[model samples]
Target: MKRLHAPAICSWGHFYIGVRNLMKNPGTGKYAASLTCTLLLAGMACVALGTFFYFYRVKPAATAGVLNNIDWGWELSYHLPYVLISMGAFSCLFSLVLRKIDFSGYERPDVWLLSLIFITLLFYSISSQIRFLDNDEYEHLHNAWMMKEHTIPFFSLHFKHSPLLEWITVFFMSLQNPSTLIIRTMRLFIFLLSCGSLCVIYLIARNVFNSYRTALVSVWIVLCNFVWMEKSPEIRPDNLMVFFCLLAFLALIRFHETQRSRYIFLFVLGSLLSFLGKQNAAIFIFSIGLVVFRHVLGSLRTRRFGIILITTGITITALAVLMIPHDIILDIGFKHLIPNDNKFWPTRFLYKILEKNPEIFLLFVAQIFLFKKIKTSHPIFKEYILSVSIVALAFLFLMNRPWMQEMIVMTVFMTLLAADALSRLFRKTGVIICTLILLAMAIPANRRLIKKYIVKKTMTRDLITTETILKISGKNDLVFDSYGKPIFRHHPLEPRYLMYFPEKFSRLELLEKSRTKFLIKDSYYPRLPQKTIHWFENNFRKTKKDPNIYVRDMAGRK
Candidate 1:
């Protein structure tokens, strides 16, 4: 029995000749015909099944905005495909394990770990495309669209959130006018930018821990952190802010390693970008300042380092003053830099960690106790993350709420600390404990990814209402949109905003009296008050074409 040659196995002749031999058997003729017929039937059944669902079952549900309800046909057509794809994924993973791939050319386990990270995040990036604007992205996307149309942030629009992320979104959006593809495309782009941040995390940890395994663990911990899972995938400014902070942190690390004056310039640029993303990122700058101060004090014997730091800071400050527009400066002074709630935010940082990422919280506690015991390649590494984490937590007290959204800061550095702690325990205490901890992170993540993405898919965003409104209303019509339903129309006045207004006056009368053209009432969680909802029901006409749309009834109004 001769073993098959590699070329003989792979060549086209192998498949062609095997088929010829099978046909020559004469015994398999009827069976092969039946198999081919079965294959044909399977292929044809796809179309038959789709037609049946479309004509009879799924289409019965009126498509006003999103399908009014999810039915059996809807589940089969939408979800079943993802289920099949997931099955294929598991089969591939099983095959990878069974057939040990070559690793001799690969130098270390970092490659394996990095590969795992890549695949996991790639899944997330792709999976994110299926989701809607689940968070503040409703307003953010609208603001970006407005910015694309040359509306100035903070001055022209009532937007106080970060500007750079919106500007970045504008850059992508310029390519195409996607009525609703905006969320999916922007989310994908954000996920890509977030990947760069992950790289920085891995590199920073690798330098600090002096071990690729620990660094990889750090990256994975951040990825699996419940906060990260919720936030990182969204089209949000905070993701960009975190990315920019990591960039600045990376620059600082490089400057320390090489003692180059150029890295200082890069650090300045990253901090500026971070600030442009959000002013609350001041904590990141504070951490960078702490590192800079340490560098200055550490090298006090040599005045050269101190001189470089001062010169760079002055230069960057001057450049910022010159380059920033007058409007932006005014905005920074009026809203961003100066105004605060004066009221302290709910002290929920501990609770958020407990509810969302308990694994990280527990490991963080362990790291605090075992700080003296953990070994790192760089001595400053210990001080670097610690100072940053402390400043971030302290800054949270200073920065509770700028607007509707609460601040989530310093999570990246905290995750690194937690991962390093877990690595230390694994090295000393053993693998079993670490494995359980990993499971705690991985299992929930698995269920979430499977259920949300594969099971039902997040369809909270759509253009049905927007298209409907555009069809019905005049160009100047005011809209009551909560989730950016009407892109080109006026900014959707929120029932929440009637509530979200800082003033004591009730703007609820605007809904009753103001010539509000349309109200989008849908599953995207429009914050309509009971009275406003009743007003819409009585005063506005709900079209059968789109039940989600409430048109202004000027004819019926006295």
Candidate 2:
């Protein structure tokens, strides 16, 4: 690893030379512009590091000793304005830097651009330290906690989501020290996957578009998106799935360039890994065939077309039979959510993207009227088009419900289109115009990023209730969370997912049969049935003076 990274290391001397070169080649005001840009980037880097330290100052232990008591609302309201003003200042400054910097002397994968990505991601992910787990995360983490005994994930994060993520969680959990907080290590895992995803996004962009600036812009566009920023650090299965899908996409793009059998093997490996991560990742398998379809069409009567179609068909079948035969529910859903929203139809989909994800949407629209000329026969052009087509069509045709984080799978294609547009725009108007356009795009994205990923505080109620549960309950205390969550090491009143299907077994019966030490609703757990609420009213009283908590009454229970 050291040998591989040796050539790309960014030394201070390199920057000094870069600066000295700027000073020497100045027409008039270039030196001052370069110095100011340097100062602003440095200042932003310090703020990012300082913010991370400020939140994580109190180190996490076995208990949640790291959490703070600051009102999340107060924190956001107090600092958000200052954050935005500062972001705008640096964004404009960096745009000037891009406009004036002599990047001609720098080589591919510019060290400065790479450093910017690393710093921004490092800052962006620190929010995971304070961010509360959503209700789905509670379920997902519970399954992960149960990984020691149950590796199958019979009723998983979404009841039917794949088990690879839970398996990986088990490996992380196994490696954690008993003295340290397991969740903190899990946070590190999520952070690593988030970083890996962005780095691959850069690689795919560079390969497809063949321009460092385009790749850099695409990475920023993806990093700044609201959904990606918000869900990037989550414990959900899709988080891992997104990383694998990008690998498959990049591998297939590589294969298209050099019909190597190794790339095909890589494509298969990535597709299988992603499929095991989440079923939705089958979109990538479909995309692979479409992206390589042109190559197959020429030999439609020959073995080539047969090979591609047969490979795709076999892959889909293998993934389906991997678990679907054993769990038929994997291929079916309970129709939990009906699409009554504005996006129920295909026609309104782009319009919704326009409203909710305006930055990528606009850039993609601009890509249609590219600012520079390109040959239609180019391999990159064809790969880009087919990929965009297959991915967009898959979303429209297959999604039972498509919005928010579901679009994470489509980010690569959207960013690719955006990068192509920026490349064309830069060709016509130079780095100044492209830089201005990028900052303009990231403004709204950063607005969402600040509100959702940075300043915004969430999961306060869960944090309070969880801490209280840990304090009041014994190691063997039986827990009954309607949401099927695990409270650290507490005993569960019944099989966790039994609550997921209330009709199969009466929760009241389970409660009566077990010790039923405590119940934690925590605001967002599913509401109890009327009879169960009545049963709880009779047998339990609030523990820790928290209304959301219910502990057994000794007088009644004994």
Candidate 3:
């Protein structure tokens, strides 16, 4: 017994020593393996939690936008399975692609990434909790449902706008459950795709720069504490447009690097899809041109191949121009260029100024400092200068007005630059020091804000529950609420602004066209001007007690 115990003890001691040695001196391969396993476990946990939440909460209430009081041929039970399938399939697709990414040296992303992710999750959580019942999302869903059920989306199927988003909306509406959780889950799905695109951008940048730190910085910037990430979960076209635009950007960058014709086609296709996503895609088209200006300027300087690339672009532009009808070409002028002063000009300009003043000033300062450093140190300084110049010029020209829509796009570009600036500045000052300062600033800033307003005024007090809106909105009802409007309304049935398109014509006309029956409004939200309140009150029957909600008569006779 003593002899056997000695051999066993020696073997066990050797095994423990071997394990300790592996842990102590993990080579690159071993480190990579460990990182991979850790990530897999983390991802599995996230999926499990997200999935459980989605099924138990999201699936039941998502159909509030489209299926509230409206019965479709599909069984309510089928939706959970469909959503599960969609989510599962999407996750598998992501896993396949993400598994290929070798996150070898990048260990800890700094506070910015963590902060951005935290802010994004919080913002989306807040927006998702509001539900889309009385939001613009409901109207969009209503229109999409109309398209599927009646063969027309925005009035009789003959509407001019492309049905790209509408088609997707209708597809989801077909699997209706009227659950807030479901609607949020759907938006979350898209947001995750956008996150994936950001990861792709990171990989591309890493490959091009051959610097893990730079790539991580770029990812942090892309997913920075920007407004859009928080707003993306609210059922809007911007999220979809951003995803497509980023895809196009990534493809174009790939093409620029590798000179691959397939990548060029992908760029064009993505740009096209982006255009189909939102009317503001013209900005993306313009951005693409600026990127191509890289080639033009290069050709001009080096005489590598002058005018040939420009000519090809012109040919493609001509083809695209030919696709649009003469009527639309004419309409663009009357509709957009010659804005009615009373209706759009003053408000738009003021909005632009308010939205851009701080960002523009800050970015200008950053550009001045960053350009000097970038010129001296960056490997791609030449390209950076050219790209920065293009972006600056576009920013100058396109920030023509301060509409909320434009502000979002502007924020997207500026936030990235800000992130870049912060990353560079912090690197120069030491990561640990900068991180401590940032945390110090963030905690106090958040605390001060919470104390000064959030707690004192009970601002979040009006953060209405989905149950409230559900009680107010019925089938065929139209909700008229802005993006930041109070949560509680007549019933938790109407889609708010974030859930719907921000366009004036699109929301009202599309609702009427879809034969919507009820309308709800909250007067407490100060964003609603007196004129807007009067208009809603004029159209719908006033509630006896609450000025906040206006109810529309279903029989078309208020």
For each candidate in turn, the TM-score is 0.71, 0.71, 0.62
- Per-residue lDDT of candidate 3, residues 157-193 (tens digit): 2332345666776666567655443354555566565
- Candidate 1 clashing pairs? none
Predictions in order: lDDT: 0.60, 0.59, 0.47
Writing each residue's lDDT as its tens digit, candidate 2 over 1-558 gives 343223223322343554565545443434445554554555454345445443544432322332334555544443332333333333334434455444453432233333445346545555555566666666665676666655334454444567787677677767763212445456556766776787687678777767766777778777766667767777787888889888877887788788898998997999888878877776666765665665556558977768888799789989977856543543433232235343354446556556766767677666656524532324555455547544755665455556455667776567777766755566677545655665566556656655665656554445555666766767667777755444354444534543544434455675676777787764534455667767767888775445577888863273
The clash number for model 1 is 0
Ranking by lDDT: 1, 2, 3
Minimal lDDT window, size 10, model 3: 454-463
- Runs of candidate 1 exceeding 4 Å displacement: 1-66, 72-119, 151-159, 298-330, 333-346, 402-409, 428-437, 452-457, 461-477, 492-505, 508-515, 522-535, 555-558
Instruction: Give the Cα RMSD of candidate 3.
Output: 10.6
Give a tens-digit lDDT track for model 1, residues 1-558. 022223222332333343344334433332233333332333234334333443444322336544576464553454333322332232233223213322222222333343445446645744665554563676677677666666544333235655777787777778766455565567656766776687788778877777656777898888776667767877788888888888887887888788899999998998888878876677777775787577766877777867887788889989998998767775552343344665455366457657767777777768878788767766677777877777876655554353322334566788888888766666665445655655666667766765766345664325345556667777667777555657666643432332232234245665566677677775532354555556667777777777777777783251
Number of the candidate with higher lDDT, 2 or 3: 2
Candidate 3 TM-score versus the reference: 0.62
